[model samples]
Target chain A: MSKHLKHLLTYVVALLLFVFMGYPFLYMISTSFKSLESFFIEPFAILSWPLNFSNYTEVFTMGLGRYFMNSIIISVTAVTLVVLVAALASYPISRLKFKMNRPLFLLFIAGMMLPIHATLIPIFVLTQNLGIYDSLLALLGPYIAFALPISIFILTQFMQEVPKELEEAAMIDGCGHIRIFWNIMVPMTIPAISTIVIYNFIHIWTEFIFALVLISSPGNMTLPLGLQRFYDEFSVNVPALMAALTLASMPILLVYIFAQEKVVKGLAGGAVKG
Target chain B: MQTVSPVKTSKHLEIKKKKKKWKHTFTICMFIAPALFIYGLYVLYPILSTFQLSLSSWDGNPAGPTFIGLDNYIRLLSDPIFFKALRNNILVVLTSVFIQIPLGLILALLLFAPLKGLRVFSTVYFMPFLMSTVAIGLLWIFIFDPINGPLNKFIQTLGMKPVAWLGSPDTAMFSVLLVIVWQFAPFYMILFKAAMVGIPDELYESASIDGATGVKKFIYITLPLLIPTMVTSSILAIVGSLKQFDLFYIMTGGGPSNATELMGTYMYKNAFLSFNMGYASTIAFTMFLIAFIVTVIIQVLEYYRRKKGVFS
Candidate 1:
């Protein structure tokens, strides 16, 4: 084939792929800007004139803000805890020579394939017994627990690559394991740490089933649960629901837009390493 | 006198070595304790609890469980819905591995083509994956809306009747399967893209010198190199398919006469909606077992394949 023909073919295929992957999102954002009458009249139109901004303002009033805040608080807290604990555990697992090192690493790695459903009922019961059900606190345990396997996996993989000499030199300076981990290992593993943070943050931010099971109150619900509630309460008012979705998805989108390379790498890093 | 001095020094060094080893073990324990405790409580213990619960009947009440000794499993063998759900779960696994992975590879290859506006094309292609499953489910619900959705409107434009995409049993699974492909194909795209970048440019250069065409080079070189990634992607898709809940739960709730019932959705309904926690545990444990068995089988196969030097 001629080079020009090949180029044209590439563009054609790219456009079709774009529509398949992206058109739904476009329709969503477009519909969010349509009034009910306009939506009913020209629901399939890519864009409607006399754009409606009411849906955007209305979703916030319907407690999207509360869900947003709850999600941020929970995700930040859980990601922080996961990073710290996973990193601490990764140091010994990756660097130290314990009898259980290989077995322990495999044990944690096995959690990646384990279904959350298996543990769902017991977790629900445990949360209730702890008197923390229906609140943000109920989510923390599972979020951190679920995030650990991958976090430890990624951190240990990266830690294994860090030169042993750096930590050994620190030890020679009379620095204890804690001191070396804090000063040497943590600094060296910042790239991996950031990947874990982004990966877990996205997972926790949009985590659904756990929130659906544990959290009941609107005020305590995360973004995914809150979005589900919006769907239930306002099934007829799709414009408003789309607006809520657009808002709920904004933070991740914006993060991706700004840090495209890092976001892609971070999201793919865990699976790619395997 | 010399022998006695040497023995004393050696004995002292042995005692010191034992003390150092004890301290090293203590430090390792301290580091591992927090993660192990949380992982054990929430993950390890819950898995055992699910297995134990699967043996009995319970209503998720304070009255406690009654040990029925695998009655739930016995009932599961006869339940039509459970069988339907298991079959649907397998459908999801097949769709993910067969359709989604190939589609993802196509998109990833498109991104590497020498085309203008590459950034725009790549960005839009990845947009579906960045949205939360809840958001994606809700968005697609509107898109598949029987009356006002663009899909039916487009169908009407084609001079055909508007179909109830999600409302009909025949189409619900297909509709959701399309959405799953859309949501996850980008993930595999990035995975393939990362792997593709690791393929050395020198190999392609050598192929060019050998008078190799694009397709030939891809077949002989690129495809062979991507086998590891393909294996990893298949494993992820299969395990992921078994555990998928949010999309199906939000989209159809496994309805339209159970046409789209997956094990995850079925288990959710049993536990929360119907309050049959024990049967739910039974389904949930079975999902774990399937995933575990599949993972182990894949690992063993991959190990033996590597041992036999199949790919390398």
Candidate 2:
């Protein structure tokens, strides 16, 4: 009887913790669609309010459109490059019987330990020197670098998993290295690549430090920078802020709704090992 | 008679082998070129320059920078603010391992049970990780706002005085810690739950055969197997806490006399607010140092624990 009671108690605790963990998100959604009068009054009214879409309208009109556009451009461009580079680089490093391969692998892994905070001032100075300090390209350079180690690590592990026998068979058929890589290896790693793209997209989309310090002008602000503007002022309408936040999270949420499985597959393995 | 000709041809084949070595070198270069060129030009070069800047002194203003060797490093060593920042980072590390991770583990264990609607509960728990940290900070700021905030309201409802959460110096660091842990524990919970699922069923089955209690089985079987994963998770938690920027930067801005300042926040304050490029580089190096040290220590600890048969 006590064993059954204990099982019952654990489930109750799980439900309560789930609610506690998710309250802010629920509250944000609630507050975003809420009438101004009902903002503070509807504390935990999970089932009470009708949806209001005005805040989203306010978000698009009030300069967040550009930020949203910029986020897309930066994340897409960066993630694509990170994947392409990681694939090519990781392929040879994992496959080729070269003398310096292990050390080279170690080099990128060590680079993983280098903190973004450490690279901040130097990257800013370098960007400034290159005359692109306030440009989108400047943000991509450091983000790509910072993302390389993990991308390469993940990609290398994935590339190594491809059957050597397939490559051997292709080699015996007079196929060249590039042909085998394109036709045989690339297809197998697509899931890993997709996971990389999604993970890196979310990571780069939300990255604020490089964006904040590197790009000063309003014309170049990313979502984190734009969200920060609301934070700077004394009286940003809480509902409007929530509205903008909800909009900012759309890409991540939409992707997650479909791709949470792949994400768990990707990170759970990497997380356990490293 | 043909044997003589075959031996002569075999000697000539050695020349072909020499040329094949060069061809292999070319193929290797072709494969690695674009990756190296891009990474070298952008990522590798920036890190090198940052390390160089850490050794010099210059404010990052339009006049460019003047070189004063080791001043930033000297200043960092003697600076009270840097020490305070380091202390706060350590607190984040401690709270993660001691409070957050353990709580996450227990929560995950509960959530991993064969209860009804566990899937729905799992999704709900992981919701915070998918949300924006900036939005989270803003929400919590209001939640802990001394006036008309939920925290104070709850206290008032209980017939108690309100505590200044984000306002007071003494409470501020703990307050920030609380907010971060709340936002992040769900993440650890889901990750830990996934790890728990990988533990083999036979371990539990065997333990049950030996008449082991559930708690005893967990301590003996589950925790040992999960140690390596927990270590890696803890490292991520430690580093994430160390490099935490958006939440602390927006919520507190390391104010109330630098009470809530972390390494990442302090680096920003130095680099941007003061335009002290050299000092910021030094602080950045300081972070790199701490991360490197912590990572090394974790590796060593893992080694020793394994050597001592602690996990086995």
Candidate 3:
């Protein structure tokens, strides 16, 4: 009898948690399917028939596509650069026995705690001096630099666990360091590489402060900035704003749905050891 | 196979070895240069520049800055809003450590319960963590809307008056902190879940054989074993709390009379809104110092804890 009571109690708690966490998402998506008049009249409805699609059309027409494209360009470019550069740096730090290896690795790992606000003013000033203050190109430098620490840390940890015999054998066969790095270390660290790619891609995709400070042009605004501006411009249009948010959030949600385990592991990679 | 003289061959081998060492050193430097250059130019240099700017009085003009050594810091000592923001930031740290961490452990435990539809429960629980902070903030604003929001609607159903959750000073900080907890608890859930997975099954089995109940096993086995992860989660919470900006900026902009202002939003207001770059740099530098000091303290405490555990 007590076992049955415990089972019932578990379901009750689970149900309450599910409601707390999931209702807002359900409401947002549901409200996006309602017209303005319907939303005002029946704000608590669960998206019944005669569903409205105009909110999606209206939000898309209002320059959300530009923000999406900008986010894609910046996130992809920055992730690619960070992966390649971090891998090259991690190769020597993890594999070689040079005197500066440990200190260099520590320098990069220490960056994980450095707040971006500390760098914002100087980076803003530097971008202005470089004449790329409002351009999409302005974000690449900070994005790649800030991403290096965690990427290099993850890559080096994974690389240290890689077996050394094959690389030593390759070295004996007169293969150069570049060749061994490309052929051996890069191939071996694919899991860590993927972790960093997913990790950095998500962060850069939603990055706000740097873009908010450096990029002022409407055309160059990333998704987060564009979304905030859109809300400010049309604060009363709740349905349209929900539509915009739903669209803005689709990519990451889809990625999580399809690759749930990978996303979870990638996100927790910073705080937990695999 | 060589017929050459031994002395000449040995001398020739030494020259070759020297050349190889030089090549190796060059390769190492080449591999590290790009990452170092970018990190230095963007992160390291900016930190020093922020410190330098904090010592000056610059309104971000075309003309050079006026160096008023330590004036910004001196003024910051008496700034009321700065202290309020600091107090709010500490509140977030306390909320994250006490509320979010325990709530996360509960949610993670729920996922492990012998119940139905756990997959569905976990998926929804983690949904908030996956969305952008801006999106989450916007969604919650409507949910807290006084006239048309669901929370007020539910209150009306209870025959109570509607409250302006984000508009009033009394509830503004609590409302935003609630949303923050909702958004972040799942993250700690995953962290705890990962750590729980690492606990050996043999321990649980042995506990069961010794006639231990579920609560007893949890207290003796699970809680003590989660100490390291708890420390890590606390550090993440504290550091993350200090750097928080986006959600508060979107939800309240530190408004309703500065009730929700954080150092991040305060710094942004000074730098971008007012162009008080010098003062903003002071706030930013102070943020960096607080985070650095807190991290060092936690690590030292952890080191001693581990040492005591080893001896005992």
Per-prediction DockQ: 0.89, 0.60, 0.81
Native contacts retained per candidate? 0.91, 0.58, 0.74
TM-score list, all predictions: 0.98, 0.93, 0.97
lDDT of 2 at A119: 75
| lDDT, ranked from best to worst | 1, 3, 2
What lDDT does candidate 3 reach at residue B242?
89
Sort candidate 1 into its docking category: high
The most accurate candidate by TM-score is 1
Winner by DockQ between candidate 2 and candidate 1: 1
- Which segments of candidate 2 are over 4 A away from where they belong? A40-51, B1-15, B303-312
In model 1, what lDDT does residue A25 have?
82
| DockQ-based class of model 3 | high
Residues A124-167 of candidate 1: C-alpha lDDT, one tens digit per residue: 99999999999999999999999999999999999999998998
Error of 3 at B110 (Å): 0.6
B53-149: candidate 2 lDDT, tens digit per residue: 8777677657666678888788999999999999998898899888888878877887768788877777777666666677678878867878646
Off by over 4 Å in 1: B5-12
Which stretch of 10 consecutive residues in model 1 chain B shows the poorest summed lDDT? B1-10
